[model samples]
Target chain A: MSGLLSPGTKVRVRDDWPETRGPCHIRTPHYLRGAEGVVEKHLGAFPNPEDLAFARPASRLNLYHVRFVPQAIWPDAGGEALVVELYETWLEAA
Target chain B: MSEVLETPSDRLLAAVRQLLTDKGVVSREEISERIQATDAATPAQGARMVAKAWVDPAFRARMLADGAKAAEELGIPMRGMPPLGVLEDTAEEHNLVVCTLCSCYPRAVLGYPPFWFKSAAYRARAVRDPRGLLREFGTELPQAVKLRVVDSTADYRWMVLPLRPAGTEGWSEEQLAAVVREGDMIGVTFPKVS
Candidate 1:
């Protein structure tokens, strides 16, 4: 509830790869890691899927819609923008 | 090359089903019934909502505000499902939906995802080359239009309310719904009158 990121905040997806953790469920796409974008909206908190995958006791985490210019993620992509919902833990202030 | 019978997921599914049945957690009849209910849902449910929105301004506003609730108004069950977000396509913008991580779709309204939606190629190309993917699906858009690609990666699910095509101005709701295909709501193609 406290310190939740707001819309329009500049943020970047944490570039940590989950390869070390074998057989993990990651909601964040690999292509989005390390990509910088703006917070489009706050989608409320939900149980962490990473923990739910393993049936671990999970805590709620804030989710936000992060929007980026297609070119930002892929250099050759068109000028349109793409939005992805990311858990707060996966993002940091850009 | 060695022949393969079942993948790991197939084995896991079979094992889980057996365990659940053995433990009496869920009966075999219940499992089959649930599967039947899931398969009963189809794109027509979404098309009906779209057609109603086109005809009634109030329903459209309600649907835009809360997609899940709006669906419930039409007798579709949304209990225990992820929130549904409806994206509106206008003259200046278009909305495309994808689940980059997996095929997290609005099964209550659209049933199961098509095989292509679960392919790795579609998942990767949706974010990397949305325009190219759309072109392959026979959807051509002008550069000026904002092609908003929405990734339903987490809790929320999304569907597109494609812009009504020109013509069919006096058409009935059934006629409008008839033109709406699953690809239209998924943002791969537009509903055509012809």
Candidate 2:
């Protein structure tokens, strides 16, 4: 998970979730799904929380500080930016 | 006289504590010691760090680089917690922190979180409408300033390093810390000379 992504990488948050993904207990927010953002920082790796939430053996996932502009998340909003920490599993190479 | 009633969650917590004690998972004394440690921490610790950063350039550099280590240098204990990061607010950019999932805070430095921080309304609105939320907290930022809202949704806790107020030159570190408030470190409000 550490080497999967580096800082400053362009990523797109996955918009769709499969039914097999199980219950929605992941840390990645629903509003950020399908949003495009730049990886601001690599915030170290931690055990996959989706697995950990269910008491399963958790694998590590690369966590990143992704910065999204207001226009990307909310078209009518001002020119502010939102930085959300996301795991590797919720992101795709844009 | 009537007996006091216990909420379902409270009863559940009691049952869990009993089970843990029975299973030898944790002693009551250990739990009490952990609670005491958490109680001992306060916003003053964070304010002291901010004040030190304001007066000392080297400490500021270390604080901005690694918050957890910088806190340790100041004798703040951060046992069994996630890494800590300090976000610096500059003239160009203002930073705010929110945890939409849960209230993940740097309690080691800032003590217990305020009740509003854990409110569902705050968690939802902070990300959806940050400026409006800030306005509610009496913070009116200039339109030109870039607002950077940070969501603490991972294994890292964050605190804001507010810019030192003007006209406070030649002030001692203790004096500077007196002006730094908990809300300022949380980025909901700014520190003033008064």
Candidate 3:
């Protein structure tokens, strides 16, 4: 997932869970799914924990600091914004 | 006639610890040593860094640039700890740190995680309603000031470099540090001049 997205890249979180959600463990929060945010910065690459959770050989995945306006996530949320760290696998080009 | 039982998480932790000890992966002494080191740290460590940054422009720049390195310059041991990220609070923007997934914190500087920091309500509402949470903490910001909540969801740990209180210009670094509290460094409240 490295070199796929840089800082300030616009991306959206995948709303649906993968069909093979059997043993793969996801670290991203459930509320962030289907959310739109811009990459605040690149947090470097780490071994994909979804595979690591199962004690499997894992490839590195790029982690990003993504910023979302409050309204983008919850319409009634005020003017504040949220910045969450997400792995590359959880994002798609917006 | 039933007896109480250990929670699943507690049982799991005990099992894992026993397994690790049995396998010789990590000795019990090593775990105790790490826990002792963490317990030795306190919010005063973070306040000291903030006070130094407040007095020296160069140190402030370095602290904002790289928190772990800046902490080391102040003789704070950061070895084997995650990178520290300092969030500077301005009149225009106030910064807060929360780990929605779990309580990932700057324990190297701030000691153990506060009870409220690990609460489920804080994790769920901090991102959803930051201003409301701040208000609950007795922090009332002006309507115009934009609140930015940074989720420490990854390897990096974060702390807030709160704005220096007014009327503290002539105060020494130690004096300034005395005024900076744990909540101030956490961005839930501001440091008081007195």
Name the weakest run of 10 consecutive residues (lDDT summed) in model 2 chain A: A17-26
In order, the Cα lDDT scores of the candidates are: 0.88, 0.88, 0.87
Q: What are the per-model DockQ values? A: 0.69, 0.68, 0.62
What TM-score does candidate 3 get on C-alpha atoms?
0.86
lDDT by residue (B122-174, candidate 2, tens digit) is: 88888778889899999899988888899898889999999999999999999
lDDT of 1 by residue, B1-194 (tens): 99879999999999999999999999999788777667777999899889989998999999988999999998877766789989999999998888887798988888778899889899888878888899999888888898999988989989899888899799899999999988899998999988
Top-scoring candidate (TM-score): 2
In model 3, residue pairs whose N, Cα or C atoms come closer than 3 Å (at least 3 residues apart or on different chains), thus clashing, are none
Query: For residues A1-94, could you state the per-residue lDDT of candidate 3 as single tens digits?
Result: 3366877889998896763565446778777889999998877788887788789999988888899887877888854778888899888889
Ordered list by lDDT, greatest first: 2, 1, 3
Candidate 2's chain A scores what TM-score? 0.85
Please tell me which model should have the higher TM-score, number 2 or number 3. Answer: 2
**What does candidate 1's lDDT look like per residue over A21-72, in tens digits?**
6788888888888999999988889999999989999999998989998887
The candidate scoring highest on DockQ is 1
lDDT tens per residue, model 3, B28-117: 997787777777789999999999999999999999889999998987778889888899999899998889888999988888878999
Candidate 1: lDDT of B22?
A: 100
- Restricted to chain B, the TM-score per model reads 0.84, 0.86, 0.84
Instruction: Name model 3 segments beyond 4 Å from true.
Output: A1-4, A18-20, B1-33
